[model samples]
Target: MNRCLISAAMAVFFFFLAWAVSLRQALLFLVGIGLGGVLAGARFGFTTGWRLLIENRDASGVMAQLFLLGLAAAVCMPLLAAFPGELGAALGPPSYSLLIGAFVFGLAMQVADGCGSGTLYKAGLGIPLNMGILPIFALGSFLGSAQLEQWLQLGSIAPVGLVARFGLLEAFGITLLGLIALGWAALRWSDRIAPWFNKKLFIGAMLLAVLAALNLIIAGQPWGIVYGFGLWGAKAATALGVFDPTANAFWSEPVNVRTLSQSVFLDVTSITNIGILAGALWIAAKRKVGAAEPRSLTGTQWVVGIAAGFLLGYSSRLAFGCNIGAMVSGISTGSLHGWIWVPMAFMGSLIGVRVRRRFNF
Candidate 1:
């Protein structure tokens, strides 16, 4: 079948999948698909307009990411303002823990080669090791979450809302225009800067805007991906009875426990992760990205990567977002955590690079 037909068929299939699932979950799943698809496209060297962000090689991915985040934040502002108490409540009050957790999680992303969403997408695309890493990372999240449940109990500073300040359309429209212009400028600047930037800047920025908006429309919540790791992790642990029931003493309420648990089965992110892998595999098969195969890595390397993934996943949950969740979605909402996580993760990536080199597996 033609690529366009295949793409259209995939869209239709997802539409039906969305229809069969809750709208919220459907939207999140689609968001995951979009994210994975874009990354995969970039990997393939297909600089399709507004879809190129393969390696984040240039400022292309960065600009697009900023736009996407800006759009979401703009939309969320009004929603929060209208329901001040509710908005203030879901995001919770910010705390110092977010800072600490975000930094560590950021580092984890570097080690893992991708954040939660990116990891899933890469695995989907037939990255031999990432496929193995997915469940192991999930396992790490579970173990780490069990260990860090206490810190999560603490809350953070409340986020400011737009609903309190402006109407939905007014907020979204203003934000959209500003974000688009900013993205456009960033793209133009990148094009003049270097080779990498020129090819991907505008497309990356536009996709960022599109993904963020699509996430808002579908998820009813802003885009996020960290919780999926923790949820899956927690569930896996719970199934194994690895956690002590009293370990949850840090929780302000039982609802947190339930939410954490529900993430395993109910989180749209998790479902999307599964779908992204499936979609990527489908595409990879046709494109000859290479068939999935188990690679021969040493036992020690596996343990280190898995351990690093666990640290990242657990830390991401504590911070309340992963790369996608915090960096993408949180930033889109203009939350402090997003900003905090990005730099921290970059530093962590440094550690990841070192570890990869040291192990040399």
Candidate 2:
């Protein structure tokens, strides 16, 4: 559990990835580690941020998040524009599924006390509830993806890419303006005496923005979390004969089929997801002994929390992604659905905070 030992293990894994996989995957693993460290070290919880804003009128976390989005977009949009052929955005359709799914995901994340990245990092940090929720979340994601085709039948328009439509400078300007506006609004709604900034959160936002940009450059795609979870679930289900990839519309695609056949370390998202876990574990190992421990939940609380975790996975798939994927990656890359996802998810968070309170979580 020594920091040096953890670093050595991470380095060994990095070399293994470079030797066995590609250099790109190895570098991405490093990026994922950076992301995990920032998220864990900063205590940056998107769910907690929204809940704080709702309950205590605190805007510091929300402002930090807005800064992260703006900074990430400033870097990402140009890179995407420069290498349009090589880089891809986290685009998702603005459909009924998005609305319903984002809302449900918002609610579920609150009840579960973690979003996708939040859950992963917290589990890595040895949080009991999140560790238990991880597999259930994967199962929910897999089931949700399996049923995605049906959700789309409710009606969806084609995805809109802002950089493609408005040009890089225009899209970047719009993204920055939107984030600034949101920050302003958060401040306006905040408690008069509430602290508007935190040094740690600000630093975390800057580091995350840089790391996220690195993830996009190395992976050739925006950073994501849920797809890896869904893939894990699919792999498990397929191995158990509980699911058939050929039968599921989403999994039947040639690309998906190929992905299913390959090792998870080869998958861009999966590699990063694993790296996040490892990085967070590294952070956990560095923490002072017995500094804090996760609170215990009653049996009923555990059941509700676990069920919410399942819903988090299912709704994230339906919503096209979670806080990290849909909101951060999507917005940073100029996807319109990412813009739409925020308000809906926030609305759900409003109700979610109430539900979380009712459950005394």
Candidate 3:
């Protein structure tokens, strides 16, 4: 019964969104649906993966994350370097912007109990807190983007692509080696870690990596989450006459302007984001996942979570991507900032976990 309802909902949504936009949008949405299913089913998540590694010393999730990065880098680097048109790399600069933003995002994710992708997928699964967090995350994303230009001016350097620094062969070689070492280290630390790979999760990880790479190929950019949220919020604010897209530096770009003018289905990331939500809902329901249990959000919990969501949004923009954009695609694309983000965010997550206990979140 649950599966049937999910399927029907997906079909109706696909038709309406497809009718409203292009076939490409429909395809992206399908990819998002797959991502939703895979994430929920496999228990794949950056935040949960990191948290498990940090708190429980379980390396399984982190190892899978590393594998996702390795495979994605192997596939995506070549395409980005060789095929420049349309398939552009997500190149974020290395600077204080990243250091500060990613750290705050790390902390916020812990407080909110979900990263960008985690938040979206869980909300789709009807997690009450995340359901509350999503809109605020969106609003925060808009506010973040609005201030992005000013933030970027704070001790930033131009984006550096490994392909540009070292030739394609060298770049791929370096990335592959780094991923290997990172994966090994993660497993070594976790006494409770399972085998090198789980058959079920391996397939899911590979599929996700491939889909993310395809996202780059089709959308002409790497997989990302926050931009779509920000765009949604900005659009809403504009509708309410509280904001103007034309004036904001972030929204003034040609591509951004086009995104603003068209239906959300026409926007690549947004298309996929909506897909992820619906897809996760479908899978969760099918798996007998209930809406976030009746845990009511207290006043303090709400304040903390909402504030954290806002920071997650603001910091993600300043840093150039969230977990998906900055960490996964960043390292895959061979950006130094991606490397920089990992440690900073990890340290922040450490702090966030401690803080979270206070709020009992």
- The numbered model that scores best in TM-score is 2
Q: Lowest lDDT 10-mer window, candidate 1?
A: 45-54
- Candidate 2, residues 1-361, lDDT tens digits: the string is 7888989989999999999999999999999999998899899999999889989999989988998999999999999999999999999999999999999999888999999999999999999999999999999999999999999999999999999999999999889888888888898889969798988998999999999999999989999999999999999999999999998899999999999999998999998998899889989998887787877899988999999999999999999999999999999999999999999999999998888888898
Clashing pairs in 3: 86-220
> Candidate 3, residues 1-361: lDDT per residue as tens digits?
3778779888887887668777777788888998888887776778877787788887777788888898999899889878867577778989888899989999899999888888889898888888888998898889989988888888888898897799789988888888878887887777743554666667878999999987888778889999999999988999999988888898999989988988877889898898889878886776544534658878999999989988888888888889998999899988888888988998899999888988998
Q: Model 3, clash count?
A: 1
Question: In candidate 2, which residue pairs get closer than 3 Å at backbone N, Cα or C atoms, i.e. clash?
Answer: none
lDDT of 1 by residue, 193-286 (tens): 5444434544644564577556555555665555566566666666777765445553224855666645343665566665566556555556
Please list the C-alpha lDDT of all candidates, in the order they appear.
Answer: 0.57, 0.93, 0.85
Top candidate, metric lDDT: 2
- Candidate 1 similarity to native, TM-score: 0.71
Angstrom error at residue 319, model 1: 2.0
Clashes of each: 24, 0, 1
Better of 1 and 2 by TM-score: 2
Q: Which ten residues in a row have the lowest lDDT in candidate 3?
A: 285-294
